[model samples]
Target: MDRPVNALSKAIRRRLGPSRLRDVLHGVPLGHPLHPAMAMVSAGCWIASAVLDVTRSDPRASRTLIATGVGMALPTATAGLADWSTLHREQQRVGFVHAIMNVTATGLYTGSLLMRMAGRERTGRALAFTGLGAVSVGAYLGGHMAYRQAAGANHAESVSHLVPLGWHDLCSLKDLPNGRPVRRRLGYIELFVLRLGDGVSVLADGCSHLAGPLHQGRVTVEDGDPCIVCPWHSSVFRISDGSVVHGPATAKQPAFRTRLRQDGVVQVRPAD
Candidate 1:
């Protein structure tokens, strides 16, 4: 099952290779996942539409909510494309279902808005109700993607729970040159270690945005703070804390505490 799925994903990737559409959806410039942000905006509009339905009968309010809904759809579409482009077949199937449901809901809302503008009040209300139901179903599917599939959730966070206490040798302090990151493995955990003059920093090797290798990233100073610029997407993270300095990544990288043992060995443990 997994083999076939992998083949399918590879085919999809080949078909969509190096596309501007994929880049926009992936939020490549932001260095983080974009779906969650777009989802929040869509959800907000839905809530506002629900409120207007209950609190007022004015066509103007309905039109306003519908326009906002339409506006939110653009980012939602981008996010869906971004997520789908990189997904395995099983996840992609689920994502496709989610996308269909959400897009249908958007269309329904658009029709409702048009109906309301044309003074077809009852038909518009009916369409709005249908759209609301579809959006709810789409939201449920999105939750499944995040919680069950771990889509858009930070994979690096998984290591924080499993990393052993106290310092574990990563590499010799000399192995990492100043302003360059080195990759090392501790058990199943991969880490990116940076030597910054007198200090050192460690973060999970995978980027929070797209699992891009952080070891190949470049170190620079931003606003008087040390940060690593991801080689793949250029997402920047503070060296001291792993906080995102810029996004497509809303979540921070999993940081690790570093030390130099008396034997001059470099060590790291999950940061407290």
Candidate 2:
């Protein structure tokens, strides 16, 4: 499964590449993954159609709903696949099976729609009920992948609540490598600290995309602004205020204001 999944992921990446379409699909503009919201459209239509079927309501309405759901599944699936392509191996495997289930359900619904058009309403209703079951399983798998595996979750810990209101000592100024990023401890949270002579910039160590350690990431200047690229997924963040320049990550990494004391200790507090 890993081998084939990897191959398929590669294909998807190649097709998607880096573009505005990919950014939209990744939900960078929306600040969340688009698939879950898109999925509800199709799911709602199918569920409504099933309810109509059980109550023996207007057959015409049921037919319309089934067709709508079938049509919407294409865009819903495209969004899900775009997100799945950027996930980890375990996540991709689960997403692959989830996609298979959805595809099966879609096929069943398509056949049911055709059957009803051919005057076999009873068989179509039966097939629609079966599709509901398949889609239910797929929904469960999608939830598992999103929740249990923490895929597509914002991994950066919010620091405003944890840290005290006042400035606190971070580490000795001498400890940080000059012009390079390094990890430092502050309270219960970790900090990604970079030094340039007397100046320092601080950001939360966890990558917002997947909690990839930002301290281990490489630094580069983009548009003359110092930026750090997440090693896990290459999310580029401006070090000045931790704003995402490029993503998989839509959420901003928490930034901090830093000052150096005359005694050679660095002090930091949450940027207000």
Candidate 3:
């Protein structure tokens, strides 16, 4: 599977690399992965068709639903593939099988639609029911990946909750290098600290998207505002406020407010 999956992954990267289209597909604009939301359309249509079938409703309505679902599969699958390509190998393996099941289900529904048009109503209905079963399995795997595996979850949401509600000493201002990002321990949570001239900025070291270390990432200026690009997956967040400048990461990195004491010790507390 690695050979083919790796090849397909490379192809997808080549096509969507660093483009707004890739960001759209990745749900960067939406602040969550688009695949799960897009999938609901196709899945809903098919499920509705199944309900119509169970009730022995109008064949035409069922046929239309099946066709609609099949038509929507292409875009839905494309969005899923885009996210799948960036996931870890374990998640990718599950996603690969999930995609196969959906493809098989789509094929079955397409055949069902064609058969109905050819006047073989019974065979078409049978195929459609089978397709629903296949899609159900695919949906189950999708849920497993999302809920159990946490493939697309925000990994840094626990920062504020985990940190005690008060100012904590970070480091002395002189220990930090000017204009360079560094990691510092603040109780249990790691912090990304950057000092420029007399001012200091701090953000959670773990990225909100996938726990990628922001301190290890490179800094760049976007629209004249400083931003940090995740070294793991290239998620970009504004340094000043930890807002997402670009994603794959929907949630902002937990930003911290900082102050310098008269003794030049840096102190930090979770920003409101």
| Predicted candidate 3 versus true structure: per-residue lDDT over 1-272, tens digit per residue | 78778888778877777767777888887778888988899899989988887898998998899988998999999988888887777888888899999999999999999999998988988999899899999999999999998888888775778888888899999999998899999877789999989999999999887799999999999999989999987889999999887767777888999999999999998899
Candidate whose TM-score is highest: 3
How many clashes in each structure? Answer: 6, 0, 0
lDDT of 1 by residue, 1-272 (tens): 45654565566556655455555555655556767677787777776877778776666876787789778898777666646656645666777778788999999998988898888978888898899899889889988988898777665565767976677888877777877788888888888888877578888889886688889888888899988887765667888988877644546888888888887788788887
The residue ranges of model 2 lying beyond 4 angstroms of the native Cα positions read none
Error of 1 at 165 (Å): 3.2
TM-score of each: 0.65, 0.92, 0.95
User: By TM-score, is 1 or 3 better?
Assistant: 3
**Clashing residue pairs, backbone N/CA/C < 3 A, model 3:** none
RMSD list, candidates in order: 6.0, 1.8, 1.4
Q: After superposition, how far is residue 37 of candidate 3 from its true place, in Å?
A: 1.1
Q: Which prediction has the highest lDDT against the true structure?
A: 2
> Least lDDT summed over 10 consecutive residues: which range in candidate 2?
17-26
Per-residue lDDT value at 113 in model 3 = 94
Order of candidate numbers by lDDT, starting with the best: 2, 3, 1
Which residue pairs clash within candidate 1? 30-247, 30-248, 31-248, 31-249, 32-248, 32-249
